[model samples]
Target chain A: MHFGIISTGPISAEFSQAIKFTDGADISAVFSRNAESAQAFIDQQQLQATAFDSVEALCASNDVDAVYIASPNSLHLSHALVAIQAGKHVVIEKPAVWNPAQWDQVWGAAEKHKVLVFEAARHIYEPAQKIVRDYLVGKKPKTVRLNFSQYSSRWDAVEAGEEPNIFSLKTGGGALVDLGVYPIYDAIYWFGEPDGVRYFPALAPTGVDGAGTLVLVYKDFNVIITIAKNAHSDAPSEILLGRETLRLSSVQGIDLVTEYTAGDEQVLFDSKATPGSRPLSELMRFEAEFFCDMIQAHLEGNFDEARVNRYRSLTLLSRSVNEVCTNARYTAGIFFENETLEISG
Target chain B: MHFGIISTGPISAEFSQAIKFTDGADISAVFSRNAESAQAFIDQQQLQATAFDSVEALCASNDVDAVYIASPNSLHLSHALVAIQAGKHVVIEKPAVWNPAQWDQVWGAAEKHKVLVFEAARHIYEPAQKIVRDYLVGKKPKTVRLNFSQYSSRWDAVEAGEEPNIFSLKTGGGALVDLGVYPIYDAIYWFGEPDGVRYFPALAPTGVDGAGTLVLVYKDFNVIITIAKNAHSDAPSEILLGRETLRLSSVQGIDLVTEYTAGDEQVLFDSKATPGSRPLSELMRFEAEFFCDMIQAHLEGNFDEARVNRYRSLTLLSRSVNEVCTNARYTAGIFFENETLEISG
Candidate 1:
C-alpha cells in the first residue's frame, strides 16, 4: 500500500517512520503548502516519494493508494473530503473532526466513495486494550478515573508570545480535543455513549481549555476523564470494575496495563521490550504500524475475525469516537456551532 | 460545660471518651428511651453522670449546660431543638439536619434561645485543614478531587437482613449524608458555595446513595467529590492549585496532609503524637477536643483570636457546612424536601 503524507508536521514524520516497520506499506507522496519543507522531509527521511505543493496534487496522485491526514485539526474535514473524493483510503489523526456536522460530512464522502477512513487513536489498537476488555468481560465496571496530563514542551514557546497551533483556539486546539480525546474514546470504546456528560474546564488565556475534568454518566457507573496541558500528574489512570481494577501507569500511550484483584496485582500487558526499558518513541511506532495494518486489512476486503472482533471496522470506530469527542466538547463549553479559525503559519 | 448525651449509640461513646481530653467539658447527663441502656452506658464508662429515661428529662436538667446530640440522623433536628428550647448549648453530630428547612429551624431556635450549636466535623478542626488553607492562600485552585470511601462494616449486617441505622433509608441514612458530607464540607470550607452542583449517585437497594460523585462548579474551577460506603478507595484526595498540590492520604479524618510543589513533596501536618506512630482513633480525639474548645469559648464569651481566625464561631461554621451539605444532597437526589422519617427503635 502506497501512502500519501498530509502535512510536514512532527506527527507526519513519526507516521512515515512507523510505516517502514510494516510489510507492504510505504510513503509514496508528501503534501505541504511549503514545497521546500515537503521536499526536505522526504530528503531527510531518505524516502523515494514525490513532494506535492498542494493537497489537490497529492490527492490526484495515482501512485498513492491511501492518504495519511496529519494536517491541523481545523483542516481535517476539508482534507479528508479531498482524499475521499479522489477515491483514496484516508487515515486522519486523533480528533478526526471537530463536531458531528463535520464528522457526518467526512464519513458521508467516504461511504459514497467506498473508501476507508480511520481515526488514528493508537491506544484503541494497543495490546493492553485487549487485556482490559478481557478482564472486564464478566465483571461490571463501577467507575473509571482517567488522567492524561503532561506539561507541554511547546508551552514555553506559547508563553514567549509564539502561537503554537496545539494551544490555539482557532485551530480546534484545547486540552480536551488534543489530549482528553484519548480517555473519552476509551470510555466510548469500553462502555458506549454515556447517558449524560458534564465538563468543567479551566480555560486558557487564549480562550481554550488548558485543563478540564469530564464526567461521563452511565447507568451503572461514572467515568471521570481529567486532561491538562498546563501541568503534569504522576498519578496512574485506572478503571474500577467492582472488586477488580485495570490501571495504566500513564495514559499517554497506554504502554502497560496492570490489573488488581483481591489484594493481588498482575501485569496484564507491558509494551516495554524489557521491564522499564521501552522508549516513548517505540510506543508511537506501534501506533503507526497499527494504523497501516488496519488500512491494509480494510482495503483487502478481509476484515480478519480478530481485528473485526476487537475494533469492528475503521469507519465505525472512527464514527463512534468522533461522535463522543464532539458531544464531550460541546458539554465542556469549549467548542461552539460557529467557530472561527485563525490557523497559524 | 456540662453536657447531656442524646443517645447511647457508638458515636456517643466515642465522643464521651474523647471529651476527657478537654479541660472544662464533661458529660453530666445521658438520655435514652430505654433507661437501662442509658444507665448501662454511664456504668460502662464509670461516669458520675445521671441517666434519664427521656430526652425532655435530660434537657430539663439544670446540671446540663449543653447537649451532645449523637442520636440517629433523623432525630437530630427534634433533639437539638429540645435542647435549644431548654436554653442549653448543643453539639450535634455531622450533618446536623436533613435539609435546609430543618437547618433553618434548628439555627433559628438556637439564635432565639442564645445557645451555641456545633456540628462535630472533626477534620475541619484538625491542624491539617489549616495547612491546606495556608498552602492555598494566594493560589487559585484549578480542581479539587476528594474521595472519602470506606467499605462500611454495617454492609454485611444490611446484606444479612439486618436494618442497621447507618444503611437504613428510613433513618435518613446513606453514603452521601453520612460519608459524602465530609468532602462537601471540605469544599465549602475551602472554596465556599459553588455556583452549581451536579451529583451522580449509585443508589443502594435501600434507595439511598451507596456511592456517588458530586461536582461543584465554581467560576474558575470545579470540585469533584467522590464518596462511597459500598467500597473503599486507596487513592489519596487532592487539591490542585496551579503547580502546587495539597493531598490527604484519606479524607476520612485527614490525619495527615502532604504538599507537592515543583516535583518535591513535604509533609505539612502529621497528627500522630509521635512521628509516624499514631493510631487512627487518636485523630478522632483531636476532633473532639476542637468542638469542646469551641463550646467552651462560646460559653466564656472569650473567642480567642486564634480560634476565631482558624474557624469562625461554631454557629457560622455549622450554618455554612449544613447549607453546603443540604445543597449537595438535593443535587444528588438523595435528600427530598418532603422526606418522611421512619426511625428504628
Candidate 2:
C-alpha cells in the first residue's frame, strides 16, 4: 500500500515515519503548499517519495495508492474529497470534518467513487485498546471517565496573544476538537453514542476551549470526558467493570491499565508496550497497518463479508464521533469560522 | 469534655473509640432505643457511662457537657435539637439535614442556645487537609476534581430487595448523603461556595442516589465531584494548584499528596500521617480534637476573639456547605421524605 502524505506539518512527518514500522507500505508522494517544505520533510524522513507542491498533483499521482490527509481540522473535508475523487482511498486525521454538512459532502463523494475513507484515530488501532474492548464484551461498566488533558506546547503562544494554528478558530482547532477527540472517540467506541452530550468549555482568549468537561449521558450511567490543552492533571481515567475497577493511566496514550480486585493490583496489559516506548512517529504504525490491510483487501477483490462489515462499522463510528464532537463544541458556544449551528448542550 | 454519644450505631461506637485519642474527652453517657443495646455498647467499649433508653434522660444527664449526635439521618435533627436545648454542645454527623428548611431550623436553634454545633466533617480537620488548604493559599487551581467512591458493604442487601438504612429514603440516606458529603465538603472547604451547582445522580432501585456526579461551577473554573457507593474506583482526586498538580491518593483519606513540577515528583506531605496508619475508629479523632477545643474554651470563658472568630467561621462554612449539598441533591431529583422543593439541575 502506497500512501501519499498530505501537508508537511508535524503529523504528516509522523505518518511518513510511521510507514517504517509497517509491511511493504511506503509514502509514494508528499504534498505541501510550498515545495521546499515538502522536500525538506521528505529529506528529513529519508523518504524515496516525490514531493508535490500542489495537493491536486499529489492526489493525481499514479504511484500513490492512498492519500493520508494530515491537514488542519477545517481542511479535512476539502483534502479528502480531492483524494477520493482522484480514485484514491483516504485515511483522514482523527476528526474527519468540522460539521455534518461537510461530513455529508465527504462521505457522498467517497460512496460515489467507491473508495475507502478511514479516520486515523491512532490509539483505536493499538493492541492495548483491543484488550480493553475484549474485556468490555458482556460485562459492561455502568460508570466511566476518559481523561486526555495535555498542556499544549502551543499554549504559551496563545497566552502571548498569538493564534497558534491549534488555538485558532479558523483552523478548527481547540481543546475539544484537537485533544478531546481521543476520549470522545473512546467513549463512543467503548460505550456507543451517548443519549445526550453537554460540554463545559474553559474558553480561551482566542475563542477556543483551553480545557473542558464533557458530560455524555448514556441510558443508565454517565460518562465524564475531561479534556484540556492549557492545563495538566495526572488523575487516572476510570471504568468500573462491575465490582472490580480498571484504572487507565491515560486516555490519549496509555501504558498502564491497572485492574484492582479483592487481591492485589492486576496489570492487564502484558507487555511494557514498548522497550523505551516507540517514538511518537512509530505510534501511528498501528493505524497505517489497519488501513493498508483493509484497503488492500478491497483492491485485490479478497474482501469477505466480515471484512466489509468491519470497515463499514468503522466508517459509521467515525461518522457518529464527528457529529458528537461538532455538536458538543457548538452547544458550548464554540463555533468555527462561519459556523452558526445551534445544538443544545 | 464529658460527651454523651447518641445512638449505638457503628458511628457511635467509632466515636467512643476515637475519644481515647483525645485529651480529657470521654463518653459520659450512651443513648439507644433499647437499654440492652446502650449497655452492650458501653460494655464493649469498657466505658463508665450511664446507659439510657430514653433520649430525654440521656440529654438531661448532668455529667454530659456535650452530645455527639451519631443517630440515623432522619433522627439527626431531633437528636441534635434535644442535645442543643439541654445546654450541651453538639457535633452532628455529615449531611446533618436533607433540605435548606432543616438547615435553617437546626442553625436557628444552635444560635439561640449559644452552643458550638460542628458537622463532624472528619476530613476537614485532618492534618493532611490543612496541608492542602495552606498550599492553596493565594495560588488557587483553575481545574479541580475530588473523587471519593467506595462500593458500600450494604450494597448486597439493596441487591436482595432489602433497604439497608444507608439505601433507604425514609432514613434520609443515599449515596449523596452517605458518600457525596466528603467531596462536597472538600470543594467548599478549599474553594469557597460555588457560584452554581448541578448534580446528575445515578438513582438506586429504592429511589435514592446510588452514585452521582456533582458539577460545582466556580468563577473561573469548574470543580468535578465524582462520588459513588454502589461501585469502587482508585482514580486519584486532583487539585491543579497553579501550574503544578496535586494528586490526592483519596479524598476521603489521603495517604499521598503528590505535587509534580518540571523536575521530579515531589511528595508534598512531609511525614506519614500515621505509622502503621490509624484505624477507622481513630480517624474520627481529628474532629473530636477540634470540637472539644472550641467547646472547652467556651466553658472556661477563656475563649478569646480569635477562638470566637474561628468557631464562627467553621459554623458559617458548615452553614454554606449544608446549603450547597441540600440544594444540589434537591436539584438532581432527589427529595427526602415529604420534601419536594425543586431547584432545577
The number of the candidate with the highest lDDT is: 2
lDDT of 1 by residue, B1-345 (tens): 788999998888777877776777788999888889999999997778999988988999999988999888888999999999999988888888887667889988987997777787776776777788777777777677887766677866765777777777678888778887788878887887788877778766666776778788888778888777766555678877656677787665665787776569888887665332454345557776776776678778986788666554455656766666666666665743246342111
In the range A1-345, model 1's lDDT, one tens digit per residue, is 899999998888877877887778899999999889999999998889999999988999999989999898888889999999999988888888887677888878987997777788876776777777777777766667788766677766665777678888678888888898888878887787788887888877666777788888888788888777776565667776544567777665666788775467888887765433454345556666776776778778976788666554555656766666666666665653255231111
lDDT of 2 by residue, B1-345 (tens): 899988898888888888888897888899989999999999999998999998889889999989888787898888888888888888898878776677778888988998778888898887789889988888746677777677887988887899988898878888778887888888888888999888877778888888778888877678888888888876778876435788887776667788884345888774366422556676788888888888888888888899989887887788888888887877877877677532332
Model 1 off-target regions past 4 Å? A153-164, A259-267, A270-280, A298-314, A340-345, B153-164, B261-263, B270-280, B301-314, B336-345
Candidate 1 displacement at residue B20 in angstroms: 2.5
TM-score of each: 0.89, 0.95
Residue range A21-131, candidate 2, lDDT tens digits: 788788889888898988898899999889898888999999999999988777888889999999999999877788777888888898999998888888888777988
- In model 2, residue pairs whose N, Cα or C atoms come closer than 3 Å (at least 3 residues apart or on different chains), thus clashing, are none
Clashes of each: 0, 0
C-alpha lDDT of all candidate models, in order:
0.77, 0.82
Interface Cα root-mean-square deviation for all models: 2.5, 1.9
* Model 2 residue B16 distance off true place after TM-score fit, in angstroms: 1.7
